[model samples]
Target: MASKPMNVVVIGGSLGGLMHGIVLKRLGHTVRILERNPSPLLHNQGAGVVAGNDTQDFFQHHDLTHRSLAVTSHLRHYLDVKGNEIHREEYAQQMTSWDLLYYVLRANFDRVESGYCTLPPVQDGEGKATYQYGHTVTALRDLGPDAGVELSFRDRDGESGKRTADLVIAADGGSSTVRKLLQPDVERKYVGYVAWRGTVPERSLSAAATAALAEKFTFFHASGVQVLAYLIPVPDGALEPGKRLMNWVWYVNYAPGSAAYRELMTDVDGKAHAVTLPAGKMAPRVWHKQKAVAAAALPPQFADIVAKTEQPFIQAITDVLSPCNTYLDGRVLLVGDALAGFRPHTAASTSQAAYDALMLDAMLRGEMSRQEWAARTMEYARRVQRRGVEMGERSQFGRHPYAGTYPG
Candidate 1:
């Protein structure tokens, strides 16, 4: 176990990457985060996060300001196929949007200027952590058994550079470049379905709809499909009623490698995408067709929510199972989506990244060996991946009145 500090470069700048950078810096390492984005992140515009325990721990441990970034609901409402509320149970959970958490993490990371609407960081430290935006990581290779790791990078100015770090942490997300380099044979398998997601501000809804959804976690299940709706802070991470928004996702199945799948990935410009079509980039015809389906199949409440949304997006759900996470004589490591992409059903990806960071920090501080860290992380990834699959499959559950809607 080595307690001495090391230079670390983290690829990818999303939640996973940022978390790793923060955790590593706290453990006394010099850390730099490479974000492929050309500029600072645009806050308050990302999808919602369920905020599992591990996710919460990262914020709590870092002492970041999070209380104002999330919204809480104490009731769970289950609706019928027609969108009629059939049963209600007391539930308690706190959720935040990805934009909010990202900005919060970014603020604590370095002296970079977070955008206009970001909440101030709860704890600002020595500023040992820095982020390099517009820098894309090209490749990483070890010089020799003990000669350190070399990193190749390309900046937005069309200039290229190289650097060496004692450790390389690849948290570049599910479509990770480092993961592709290390495990060339692995692929993100499309899980035969897609999710249609959107958000409508609370003020945009009717009084009845507002009353039904405000401060509530809600859902509706259909044959091979599931619809979930919840409230989240609005564009500025504000919790004021009118300023909040109702976000929803409808998961519907489609065959992988099918024409429908390819068509769904098509953008407004007619360019076919390999994965998601960003908000407002979905061809109008596709959203129009989905509106028609919502009108006929979804509960009236949800149908209204979908109809009023101004900027909806589509994401193709995919997962990967990577059996190994450490390489280069344990000098290089993979974390978060790079190690293994899991079905979102577990809501574990963010939390898992935190756990990975925490565990890695501990091991580097002499709590465990690199070999043990690799084995434990690999086992944990497989377990979490399998659990997500099981949870994704058992889609229909809860109060019995809606059993008929289950996709048998």
Candidate 2:
């Protein structure tokens, strides 16, 4: 009455892949996570992410704690550049620090591996799983048509090795090497806007300034641009008694091929840096312009918070989607940004990753055959990917606000 254990290999040790590995391991499978980072400490572990009830269900189902939830604030008002208040909607949901979520999930995963047992605890075959950091998967090749999947990777010491698994899950993010190998024609397109983000201590501002940002999400809209500000309780503690941090994002339209665009995308030393800009290197002066714009165009209360911040970071917004009907290839399946990278407008990246994990878990449990799983999961991905593409198209030229009506 015992079921055989499945050997599964997951590429990318971030949220989606880690979640998939955890769920499969729980279902009596031998799961291994191949992480390219040197170690767990080197991961970026993003700033903050938003999630709704459906996402919360995934966390709760996996026995995760809610204590790590960040400060929740409702969107109170949307104001135009002239300080005129537009629509006001209340979003009653929870906000959380992305790093906190990753840490919590990672901790829970470590606690679950006591000693895997067979389906009915037969005297043979207990499942075992491992997380192998510094293993960068380089190639994935089909092993005939019946041998399942084979993965080639390089370890920390630059040693090359190969692995075979019954299933392979690729959650390697936007510039996913797996995706590039499988589907060469698909590419990432840059939107005409750059997102500048930073955080400042609440105590850095005066009393009036702090009150303006107190426990509420606020957005300031302008023609072809928008700025959003919110208070997120750091992993350390709450907002009172000392000081909490306020996170801010400014969307500015930058012509793709102009000099200013090149300068804005340049590195801190004024040298041309290739890929997207990394965190915390933007010159203070460049961000000063954004603060000045906010001060001149937004409500005085919101402007005051902007003027008090220091050392903001900038990133170019780009859109990437999978080619038609190809999110999966044989035993390897793509998830999260690996499959579809969306504009930040919907704030749905984390939620979508959670959904992928849940659906994939069910499929691995034999609830659906490999063919059925690929069809159903790809359909789900297509729907979400379409929404993301529409959002990206609307967000092009930087004409939408976080609180405005969704463009059809």
Candidate 3:
């Protein structure tokens, strides 16, 4: 154990917050994760996440459940518009549904029964991890050096409460409230594009589509569009053949402030979303138009997969990087997407969260100082963020020398 145990408060009980909370809890610190979402389960809108190296390493080190976490694909195929393979490579990738990752992390942290993870909670001595849902942090106060920070929040009942912690982690995502409070000047820049994403059940894929994509990470790149498909574990965390999900993402440019952008962002109820239009909420005409474009531009297999999808979502791509991550005398940290939101081309967001958590662990264990930890995390964030921008530019605009390859 360390010389002192901390009372840590993690704002945002998503992947980033959970990873940090779990690590701190295992190091004998008491952790409380405050999540704004009132529901016991947070939905990822049927999206898939790349299980990068740090993500896998995090589970190997911190999660005691030791469950298999991803669906593996050992081949990559770049197909022409006619569905014939233009290029094939022996590349392996691990993919997981966002729901699976959340359930697994939640199981390891607070042992919340989400049905997806039925394994018994692992044992840790002296440390406690608790999650409070429907809590929105409203204010933060620093009490001088080494004196900890206090947070004011409103619960689901609209009741207000205050909590103080030796350390506070803000992993609240790209549009982070904490970040806005601390660094008001920081902003996210839209990348003039959005991803049209959807998933079909493996069993729903036709024989030809299955044969082309079942075990391969498949891609079809056009002039200004790129679509890729791969398998991911299903909602219930099953990875068996025909039980997985065939997840696909198509990147298409939509110039900011254009009429096309406006229509794409306006949902079924006429609510205009700033970043994401979730599954089942997209306007019918908008989706119909996109589907028509897919049919004309995408490979037959890719188009079929898109057509079979019941509900598709849209995520507008953006880039955000904070000048610094640590604040309030090292008692508060802006972590993960809160610190740096990258383009999805890198698929490094989750891995960035894991990396941040592990670096925090190292700091708490006296392997590094707080300044060192902050610097290291920020450096990694910048590198990945830049690479993501380059990769997106290369694929969508053919403007960069960077190859159209994802971070493995």
Candidate 4:
């Protein structure tokens, strides 16, 4: 136990929020997480994720199982305009689903087997952390370093209340309400493109399709369009071959103010969505149009995956980087996508969250001063954010440096 256990409130109870809660609680802080959704907030049905070093290190440090949590691919193949593989390289990527990693972090924090991870929580959380679903954090403010911070929240039924915490961690996501409150002028810049993502069960595709796509991070790029696909565990984290899902992401450039952009964002309810069209929400005509476009642009291998998928979704690629992450004399800190939203090309957002948690823990443990903590974390965010943008531009423009290289 610490000399003083600060009351910590984490906004947005997805990956980032849960990660911060686990790390803070591990250091003897009393934690309360506020999530807006009544049910589990599935950001997407599932996202194909690449677990980099920061992620694996976090799991190891926390005693969580990381190996069996993901589907792995030993090689990557690049396809030509036709479906023939023109480039083959050894590319080992441990690809996990968003749900799997989220639940693993949850299980570790609660010290229970959440059915997502075989490893039970190694740390004790008798009364240290509490997760409150259906609670919306409407407002919060720093009352000075001495007075800590005050937060106002509203539940699903319209009841609203206030509470005080010695520290506040806004791990809210890219479209973060807390972040807007702090820096309203920092808008999310639309990158004039969209990604259509979907997953097909291994059993649904033909044997030829399986052989072409199975066990590899396959990619196709041509004329400013890119498609990447790989296998991922089933919804329940089942890694059996037939039980896994083949996840695909097709990136297409779309002008922000074009008529096509407006039509693509119209949901089934006839409402225009700004960012993401979730699974089962896109209008029938819109999705049909997307599939037709995929057929015309992508190679037949990827076109087949799109045609077979039951629920394909689209997200307008956007960028947001805050000038500063720390505020109110360090009583309030922004973490994860809330602090800086990155392009998904590098799949570095979750890794950044994991790094933030570890670094914040170190700071709380008195390893660095306030200024040093802020400078280092902000620097990391800037560097990774820049790298992600570079990769995104390259992939979006069909100009990858590794276009013809086969490392193996």
Candidate 5:
């Protein structure tokens, strides 16, 4: 399909990297995915994701199994303090869980055995894809002229090696090592809030809670807080009733550097993390205090969902927008959150990754120039990043600066 098959190296084996790898490999390019994690990434720290158009389209085109991936909600409802619905709208959205998507993608890309997908990897005689875990990229070098880029890496066993490819893709996420190496001045800007997130088994919830949240996108907003709940597939992608999970996120403001923020951000081992405190690692005392707050502040239905959660986690909201995603004369590129990290209000992170992968596919197919692709991708990133910030400001700070100017 292409003028010539190019060797490709993808850093990070998460959604963004896997999407790019799958697309390029299908186009007859040799691809190698180096993941820092030492094992199969079957677990995700966060929960449900709204399956936007880009995500749906990517699966339709690339995923071979063509399995059902989401649970649909046909109604949207807003709740008051008493848990009574004050506003109702007919809205339909497909909700997907993080683990389901990850394993499905992995099954499609490399056919790693998992409960999500049991099919073997497809052998289409296009190109070969190799996956390596426990490889941490240590440095990057761009050879001059037609030569490609070289990357040095050390594995978990402290063994170091190097590889070169005609192109390099950095999908390492918000705290990307590749991004930091290229743009040392860029950093993650913390917003004045954090999200408390957890999931409860549908059967574990009370009848009242199930009646309120089942098959409905539910939300509640207070002066400085916003909470939402929706149903997603279980860990193995089961969507049947009573086998699903009710995922909820409550956004609460805590000023940076305050004692409250410090106490909440510190994990059970007394270590501080800049972004997420993963499930099952949160300190008991911190979780209890937040549960007490939920009892006092949240509506009864929402409060019950929180109480039933056994391992709630916290994600500190942060934003990062790089000036550009192209680097090293276009030999290296940054996509997804590495290019522009959005606030969670937009719920467009996975969609952004899908969009980036689609655009990269177009570029590799000679459908667009590298310059054009870069401009289009950066425009999309900035627009989504701005919209996420505006939405967060409106919901968390009661500001309507972008009321009539929201991006489509």
Candidate 6:
């Protein structure tokens, strides 16, 4: 006789959610993803992401093949404000665009037509799973000592409903509703700086400018700010000739609750902006000032890359820790950034998510009891989160005088 399938509900259809769903589905468990967004196509934003060797293994373990990976430019050099090359090292691995990764993963999920709020059964077997979009989980209830837990959600049409599952996985991102419901006491803290990111077409730059920024990855470090630029390939070679895009990010320190903070956080129309920094809205004058700062401070090669940028965007950095206690009343599980969001310094955000998926897969496979799984998973999360924090603390490049400098 075959064993019974586990009914699993994964909240947040982002990278982590999808990853978990795919792995669980492969393991013969019924999986469903609940996403608040209306559809997956709404996400058009893209960013360059660096994945290390560990990440490569994580991808392969989840059945992500080489064909699914995006071709990214490798890291080449780090330069100081005066155009002098400070450090040069060859990156062992490559980088890729976030959109490419998402697209590949979504295709791998193989149920894109079904929305996350609908909860329509996509896979049929002894174990069936589904994803329901526009379903905002409002509350969770502990169903007695023996029964499984219950989840309450607001559907797309604002109708409220409840469902019970053997396991609940919260991969819902930094602002996870499941996390809030499970661990209401945990708080999110803002880091001391904001990140400005944008992409420019290679054709928009002169030949010399293009040559200067054609590297895989490059960083420009100055006194109070640092800029990073990298190359990304676009489709349509020669005939349509899509320009190679240069993705750049600028990190500037800003005091919390200050006028400059307000100004920097405000949109071009003077309205408060949230989440991502708006593209093409910043004033040309402000950009010119930034360019001037780059020109005056950054090394010649790095400054040239910044000067070639079309429109630079900004985003405030924030960090959040998972609740100190694991197991929500001994039922729900929180994973990935939904538990502990780190500063983007270590480039481990995606890697950590991959780790969570693998670990959860192992635990759900009956390698350990539910309580033991929770303890071990939480320990792994804590260790990863601690690493992220350490990297973030050390990432104070502009604020610290000795940052990016090597002692002879």
Give Cα-based local distance difference scores for all models: 0.78, 0.67, 0.88, 0.81, 0.88, 0.66
Q: What local lDDT score does residue 127 receive in model 2, on the 0 to 100 scale?
A: 49
TM for every model, in the order presented, reads 0.91, 0.84, 0.95, 0.93, 0.95, 0.83
Residues 1-408, candidate 1: write the lDDT tens digits. Answer: 444677888998888888888777777778988888888664333477777777777788863444566788778888886557888898787877887677777776663445524444434333268788898888887887656799999998989999888888898878888988889899988777887888998888877677777788888877677888888877556877788889888887878889888888888898887657788788888889888888888777888899998888887888787769988888788998899888877768888898898788678778888888888888889999998877666662233344335422
Error of 3 at 276 (Å): 0.9
Q: How many residue pairs clash per model?
A: 2, 0, 0, 0, 0, 16
For candidate 5, lDDT tens digit of each residue in 141-237? Answer: 9887488899999997989999998889999999999999999999988899999999999999988899999989998887778889999999888
lDDT per residue for candidate 4 within 19-88, as digits (tens), equals 8898887887889998888865445566778888888777778645654777788898988656778889
TM-score of 2: 0.84
Pitting candidate 1 against candidate 3, the one with the higher TM-score is: 3
Of 1 and 6, the candidate ranking higher by lDDT: 1
lDDT of 1: 0.78
Q: Which stretches of candidate 2 lie over 4 Å from their true place?
A: 1-3, 65-68, 82-84, 111-127, 205-209, 237-243, 270-275, 324-329, 368-372, 392-408
Range of the 10 consecutive residues with the lowest summed lDDT in candidate 1: 396-405
Candidate 1 Cα errors over 4 Å, as ranges: 42-45, 115-127, 396-408
Over 4 Å off, model 5: 120-123, 399-408
Residues 62-167, candidate 3: write the lDDT tens digits.
8766778899988987887778887888989899888888888888888877667665555747489899999999999988766779899999999999999988
Q: Show pairs that collide, candidate 1.
A: 82-299, 83-299
Better of 3 and 4 by lDDT: 3
- Overall local distance difference test of candidate 5: 0.88
